[model samples]
Target chain A: MRKTLLAAALVATSFGAQASAPGGSGCGWGNMLFEGSNGMPMHLLATLVNGTSGNRTFGITSGTNGCDTSGALSYNGENMLAQAGVMEEVAQDMAMGDGEALTALSVSMGIPAEERAHFKKTMHENFNTIFPSEDVTAEEVMGNIQTVMNKDKQLASLS
Target chain B: MKSINLALILVLASAPLWARATNEELAEHPRWKALLHINEGTTWRYQGRSYIDDPEFFLHESGATDARAELEASIEQLRPAESEARCDFPARYRFLSQQLDWPDDGALSHCSDYQEWREAMPEERVALIFPASYLNSPSSMFGHTLLRIDRGNDEDGVWLSRAINFGATVQGQENSILYIYRGLFGGYPGYFSNVPYMNKIRDYAHLENRDMWEYQLNLTQGEREWLLAHLWELEDIEFDYLFLDENCSFRLLELIHLARPDSTLMDDFRFAEVPANTVRSLDRAGFIESVDYRPSKANELDALVDRLSASEQDLALALARDASVAEEEAFQALAPRSRNLVARAAYAHLRLQNREGERSQEVAQRGLALLRVVNRTPTVPDIDPQRPVSPEKGHGTKMLAAGGGMLGDRGFGELQARFSYHDWLDNPEGYLNGAAIEAFNARIRRTEGDDLTLEQLDVVNIKSLAPRNRFRKPVSWFVNGGLDRRFIGSKRHLTRHVQGGPGLAWEMGPVIPYAYAMARAENNSAHDVLVSTAAGARAGVLWYAESFQLGLEAEGLYYHNDDRRYRPSATLNVPVGRNHALRARIERDGGPDRAETEFHLSWRYYFD
Candidate 1:
């Protein structure tokens, strides 16, 4: 039952996006999110669609604090998988935006010591913008992050 | 009409002021009920209960009195702009916003860090991976399933991806009996764990002598996203782990349902989710595209061992036994192929010994040294082994038999049925040949008196007759307990039989023959037996083909009443499509009832 509600929610959210878009409520959710012609901001709907469950609503089956908002720790496969030990676990942790992994990732990206924590905080705050979807690769994430860094002057200053 | 409508609207608006709907009323709300999966006996989504485990997360408003108030308060908290950013249930709010067509307020910001992580682990494709059963582990012998998130193409990249596994988190110090009892009765909680695909391969392929079958699924990007979202929600959540119903395979069915919401994958497996049956369900749903077989360490070791001559095998065994002496004498002088084969076998033997905990610390250290030397020069034997058939292609788990034939000059009809799962004589197309497990099997027959009597009823019978290979030396055995009608001194009586013993089975080309020396205990009114005990020896041979199956078994029993009996049975089966088959059987029992011979034929249909 809870499963269907979320599915229904997805359907409705897409529809709402369509309504407010240029077609003004006539368009469906798909059109509202993708048509670009709609005045509705794309990032808002995109982020809203993917990032909500991160909060405490982790669902009835899911316990609270389901989302890993922290940056990656050293255990989060900061290095390649050629090495053993926790490489496998790190693969999953890094994929989940684990705080340790995110922080480790920022440190690896050459973020200064002072700015690494802030960088991890920013990454946690804007995980959707950094990841966008499942298809987004590591390179794509880096590219989008550059854009995010370039567009936000504060982020640029930290870098 | 407008005035009446206005009055009704006013009443509805004022309804929440003081005379708010009771918790039950709130629970019955269509959306609320749907959200909680509340039915007639709705208490909690998860069957497991505890005081510390918050009921608010699972219980319906009707079940938890304060739930309605808490829910209402949480919903109201979303109204204010400041609180909107930290909305309690962002997912729920988004869902409700769309479900109610309410505009979603820009609240939860972009989880850029999560995106970065997801970007690192992009899921382009997905597959259901079943690590096919390993012998000796009854819990996993039927196998276990996991979801694999694919990154690159179907080739080398599969190992680099992550696998999501769901399994019961058994408590430490839980004995096997307690584990089985708890597992069967929902005493354990199942959790989802993730690890690299390579790690899974190392565990299944190298550590556990279990072959794996990966069924690549066809799912779109959107569907994959939904699956990921659902998996995220289930992370760290404990399901009332049931060995049968909400098992590992069953939980995966629910996860897959989220991907294709319209598909009813979970509906078919409400009672039990046999891993093989679940694979069939996924196949029926047109979700599986291709299947890849991952050979286990034992598989590879056996394949290499098969190509070796007796002398070569002896040499390999000797080297494994004492690497120091054998290496000095025979290891340095051998053909490259022989060298490769011997090295691989020795490595496998050492690893197996270490894994099974038969090797001492010093021996294991020496074995590791041997492995390092073996690894230094990677050798590939020329011979390749055939891959084991995938479980998805196996015959249906449920079987029903109904037919009529003659027994002891009496024209008697009989009906037999088995709910599950497999038998040695059953078709081995998709299952491991010679392995059989059947539960709740019954055969009923009608005599000339027109009275229907149960001829035989079996509760549980399991036999794993995987013929010992060079890699695995399994002691094939059988355990069966049931009631059967046996003849003694020209009279027939129902006898309850419980028998089990170790045996040996060999698979030689088209025929698989086996022999067993079992200790049988029988209880019957007619048999004035010593302590109601008996002993038995049995021998059987089976020749199975795609279109036809032939089996014969001869058994000799000595009862406590100083009675001797022998029964020789022969049977054949011709499959009718994938789910149906025609079977015929003939049995001659040399009892006091004049050495009677019985014949029967049955047309059976199988269902998922």
Candidate 2:
């Protein structure tokens, strides 16, 4: 009976990429942020123990910040979004003119701390041109950001 | 020539004895045992054998059981000038090198694979991350814990930090019952993986809407390196994954124990290693340096919507549903700040909703347009959601209670115990509000003139009451199955039952009201039928405050056998500090032929 109860308790306890091109799938941003096998039952079971199906990632493969280092756009030999797949976060922060993502992006871009406020202001002013459209690719956004940065006197040298 | 040969043979025979004498103490060290995952006992579950199931992890055939044999084999394996053992077991190499007189021949320096990997990691700091529970998803009801290897340098912030996660490797298309069965019985193999902190943030916060608590650990640089090296050893290693004991939290505590050899972080957890309880253990060990909170995307949206006026919130919802609403007079008439706030809220809404469906062009265009308005306006302050009490501060999971009550005309004494988790009446400081998840709850009662009998045994009970509002409409739900004692024809009979349903809930300040339509199946010994089915409805209102909680609920059921039952109950609970509480409940139960009134009072003590 104790064994049966233990089994019952156990049952209850259980119950509780690449940088090929800016617009390419390798760039990591081409896929939607929340795209995957998201069946409700799967989520319920997967989250029960916080388990994943066959994800065997070694720390070695996560280059820098798990971003594709082969991205076309390079800053200090590192792609801006290459270090972090936070394009949406960056976009939101860019609109607000300041955020953790925005600051991290600027730092990755080698922008000086003193020039960040100016960088934020410039990005804020050029938000429309940078974003252009809701479907704007991350590469296109980066290009537009560089174009805008090149126009600013203080930001031009950094860009 | 024979005498020289004999002398060489004698020397060779004595070398091992000499070596064994010196290395015996080192092999017996606790650190060595921890490295092998050898605990005291003979069984495979918790004691005796190594926790790691992978045979490749052990050098000696009996290495999993005999630490000395493994240690000696490791030494022999590492003696070669070109041996890759140093790279495979760098932590062991470091430990052994300190104790033995190994030649400093730069073998470790030439391992480019290990060198390049180490260089990629900062190894300067470590943090324990807890993604708070998401009640809507029952799997996340217990929450989860992982470790983050911080790069130390703030150039990219902690977003660039490496996250270490331990989880079971399961099949994607498996059935749910099989999944649960395998998870409970250690059928799946668990492995440790490393990814970027930002990716984890996206997974937990943005996708799942679970608030994250990051606790920076205070470990010496040496300890951090030891942990990192051991983590490398564990790469691709397999351990039989069990849902209760040898789980993610348990594995991480083992790593921490390896780092701080003197700390007893893994001692208390033998049966279960709940994530929140692990955090509390870390806090008690004084290993926590500081804590930071990251609000989920849904939480941020809630804060943004909360800052708006009623009319503005309505306008924001309209803008989210239709892009043309931005052209309206009411939206256009708002001040620039208000408009920016409204647009931001709408954009957040679209992003959150995108989690459910495929990305569509229409939603994208609307979100982009809203962002354009936000960008055009002057910058407003970022939305800041109020951080609730961290999980470590919450009451423990295991609970024990004792009380005396009256049933009909009989006086009774009751004792109850719960194996895990939060209930609605418990303190809600660190748990999800309106969420109740309990498992293995049992109650026994002794009536005035009767022997002690089992009153109830709840195998599993879960309730998620996410309140509906103007911006979000989350459904409330509950499911429970267990053995219950019922009064049938003047005698008590234990019945097995399961019931569940969906409902609606609303929050208004301190008060929350909810209603549910339920369906139930029961097997009672007194009933002639094999199984009985019932349909019912339940309604309740709860008032929560810092000092106490009050609830009033009523339920009625109609069975197919022409039996009917109604129960109305009121409960009050007052917390006494963090680990104790007092509760009182009064309910009247009406059946087809009899009615009984029950009053109960209990004092509950909680612990991990």
Candidate 3:
């Protein structure tokens, strides 16, 4: 079973296929949010060898954020977090109220430098709302973040 | 009409001679050789082969072994105005077009795919990224190096940058033993991959808990573009991956050398290429414009814990264990700032604990509860981890030593050499603390009236003594296998042995103490059995200071053959400079039948 999964993964890597959301738009930001928890053993093996077991990416789909073309969260028509696969870091940084990952996220979201502190504080206060369940998908988190920002008086304008 | 035909014939006949002279001259150029991946050799025929393993990388039938033939074939293949071969090998086209003064009538300028890739990667600068060594992992013991393509605009930070990495593309599921064997013997096909910088940060800093050093290079804009075009040419090209010399570091140096042909970065390394040694080469070649440090999540957590008081630390631990502690008065009694620190520590601790584990709902809820407390309280200042000395400042990897000492009653002179890596007694400036990894180390001794003989040859020795603290519990372990000269009854004979085990270590002030339960299997000429196995225990204490290091160790082994042996040793090492040190050792080996005392002092010199 593991070998079959690895073969599938190798195919995906060769074709540069994105891990798109299930039953959703082709935004590619759905189930991969919680992927950090799975694949522990394989991940360790890859780390041990200093090699990627078919986890290669070319940054072509990564730097272009997401497929949300009509949203304020999209910066320069790109969704930075869509292919980031950094939901774990984003969650931890949100809890800490500030971190490199969180700061980078905000910067890519078109949040100005002066208003980043308010953005962090608001995210810190609503951490549970954004990440209500352990199995929360990245799509749900993105929606929750948009909802939270829409309600905040200071950050509402930016959202 | 006849006169015009004769003129055309004369022009065509003369054009062949002129172009042939230029083609021959260009084929022999140094840049062409670099592009073909040719090595310096004694003769032209011997030096013509390229290091690239894949046959598809060459345009000619015998291009892998014949550079001149490959050049001619490439020129012939690229003569058409609109050919797909130009897209496949854009860098070659660029080089040839300039050399041959090709017409600018759009003959060789059509590479839409290459142009799109170039536009996708807006790289104006390049940096060498070195993820520091993680002792727990075998392949990363010497660390790994990759290249980062940075844009001139610093709006997105480096998280959005692209990284060029070269590594073995492992196929199927292989066991650890097979993996190591194949990795060292070039059984795997290696490829160059481009990935987002954030993915690597997630892998190294967060997942593996290893810090990273970035050495920004000083290449011009044109050079950067040249390197990028070359990277595109190797999109799916395969190179045989050998873990030692022809590995990631070696390939990266090749790319950098191709960019700046005058730099001598690839001159010193031929046999083995340690990543740190490559960084040193870059520095020596003046390719480094600046250095940056990125601390790992573990390092950040340590720095955070360092700022907390003892009581606060207990409170944080309690909060991490039970979320209800946040509602109790024990947590509420502290100042708001203190509460923030405690809550932050709790969340960080829980996250780190779950780094390698499956996420649990209970732990996630508890983490959220701690974050609630942090959000309610005043925000505390951020913690910045203190940076250690850069890796280039460390001592060289190869070591050579000469000394004289006493073996039992005879005076002996000894010489020792190691092919690569650090030992426990060496300087600890840019290496992992309390870790020793050595390979291919040998020591030879000459007694007063005896011939020179090898005293010991350690094929591979690795020891990681992670001192446990309140926040982390790491297993200290060691494995050593090699041949040693041992006294069997009355004669000395070379014996083969392997010994290792797991143990515990503790950090106290400036000293770290550790103990291990060891098991050994040995083959000796003096033993009655074919192989004698032993179970034993070893304990040691190491004291580290600014200028010197001291270690005291003792071990006892009981063989299945009814033989018992005990050894107690002490060693002192004083580092004189970055590449020089003095070391002295004294040991007493005793058994039920015989006892011997030996001492040695040596001056060590290190080089790449």
Candidate 4:
């Protein structure tokens, strides 16, 4: 398929240069050659082969393309907040104490999966400060999050 | 050039080429051919000789004859930093550079203008938005979808973000039926357009009284960048619009496919796309990170009204209707939250009902005082509801039914099937309970003699019965045009049917009920194909729990020259599993000449 070729050529050309930064050496560029980008042909073919199995391709294709998971964070200030809308919802979730926004917020805060229970409690307790009744703006929330992030060792490095 | 050479070798190795290929032919080279669907003149083979509608988007120096030249011209514009670039070129450049392995030109310096706009914006977030069905409108039955490009603002931006909507660019004078027919049959040009989220909020929430659901997407910035740029490529390009397979929902699925090429979101939807089902595909792909519910103004008003005691509601109603209620003891005795809640409801009710100017200045002034008192308590009444179940958890659109039954005196085996959508009489869990959009449903039965006959068929049947509460008084409506066999004149009759109109519907705490006034037409085979037109009224009720659904429908019509009749039907359904159900239906359609009764039952299966 065209996308596979393009991905191949892209890897051929950008591999050496990308290895140093966000495109970690062990990441997906090498895998794309074997799997061929999940191009339209393979996608269609997989659908035909799977035939009503329910959730056929995502289990295999997800995070396999080096872009979604196990991918190094971008240094371009295009952090999770800039790239995906999750962090925005995450802020609201911290206030609500639950939902997709919370999951996104947790990931953005770099909290380990196991520690999220305590992290969630901390978030719930700090909801008032995060969304203070006083002067609140984007800067204030960011500053508040920064303060919270610094207090926790894991999130401290991110701050 | 090396990449081009590699592409050239690949193309040559794969297939023989015409000697001295035309520029058009060169555009069909493997590398270029893959993108041909995005080009103007490229043939899509099966979509009925359709061509992209915008010529300027495809024009090259050679009078648009050379697609390769046009692509090069287009790519040249993408080579600059976004701010320096013209026409949001980064959208194009980002995609091409990533996929084509174009050489990186160092870190992109922020396009000052774009950066400034972004800085003023919230974080970048994408949500696949669905405005639940509003029955009075046929086009909204399967519901409609748009992408909300949330600028990462909190709750506020979900209502203020940019929305990408793909819809037909109809000019004028076309009636609803004409519009529906053309929309389903590719008789219009579809365009992708953007507008502020507030505009959509006003349209879907305030004006339409439809609640919206926003499913959060967890796409990375790279994916978002590709999506944004692909939208740029499609900015001016137009595709022939066909509601069945290439409507708003289908186009949105294509956008997602472009973003996450690894996912096949458009497969089951190749023939027809249900907006809700398309969303379900996104969820299945594991792309949906979360869901957010946006209550319409009416929903808010209803929630507020519910909090008030009936007497308080009456006081608020009086205050909203006239300016003399501030002195009433009932109004004066309420607590701040209750006063604020009632005042807010009253004000919203007046505006929503389009009677804002009727509330006197005295009333308005009193309402404002109550609002000011209400605001003193923390924040504006925040009653954001918990997210609803995702539609994917609902029964699949396509269904198959098989069982044995009796018609008249003979025993029979039957099989029935339906395409696209849901019906209130079907499983009600995980779907808009009262909304149904079914098309091309057909049933066939074989009697003891093994004689096959068409029992009944519906060409298209769409219904939206969003229940109006005291806060929201939405009009319910339906349109069904198809063939059906009913007992008329003491015998079975198959007639061509067409009917639609407006009605009132409400969720009366325990049950959802609706009524309609419709104009109907039918071609009766029993009457030698004589066309019959009539004005009719219908009423129905639907009672549903997670595993059970029951519905009753009754209708009466007066035909031309005083012919009159009434038809009533009842149905009950029990969901068998995620993909199966059992249903029983009974009906008695009475006419001036005759009244006939029938009962039927079947077990159903579903496919995605």
| CAPRI-style docking class of model 3 based on DockQ | incorrect
- For residues B1-608, could you state the per-residue lDDT of candidate 3 as single tens digits? 99999999999989856764576787777667767777654112224467776887899988887888989998887766677888887778777877777667575357776776677785777999998865344324467788998765564467757778776544334554555566656576767777667778977787778889999999998788678878877877887776666677878888888788777865552666678878888999999999999998788778888888988898888888987898899888998888888888887787778876456788877766776677678777757889988888899988999998997899999999987678888988887777887766899999999998989877666677877877778787777766777655555767677677888999887798999999887777788875688999999999988899899999999999878878899999999999999999999876777768889999999988
TM-score of each model's B chain?
A: 0.82, 0.94, 0.92, 0.79
Docking quality level of the chain pair in candidate 2: incorrect
Where does candidate 3 stray beyond 4 Å? Answer: A1-85, A110-129, A151-158, B1-21, B41-47, B103-110, B135-139, B173-182, B487-493
Against the native complex, each candidate's DockQ, computed on alpha carbons, is 0.02, 0.21, 0.11, 0.02
Where model 2 places Cα greater than 4 Å from the true spot, the runs are A1-60, A63-85, A112-114, B1-21, B40-46, B80-82, B175-178, B488-491
lDDT of 2: 0.75
> Higher lDDT: candidate 2 or 3?
2
lDDT of model 2, residue B400: 99
Identify the CAPRI category of the predicted complex in candidate 1.
incorrect
Angstrom error at residue B397, model 2? 0.3
Instruction: Kindly list the per-residue Cα lDDT of model 1 for residues B269-351, writing each as its tens digit.
Output: 24556778778888988899898887776766778777778878887777777766345656667776566667667756756
Report the lDDT of model 3 for residue B418.
88
Task: Compute the DockQ of candidate 2.
Answer: 0.21
- Residue B240's lDDT in candidate 1: 62
- Candidate 4, residues B48-67: lDDT per residue as tens digits? 11135456445345424455
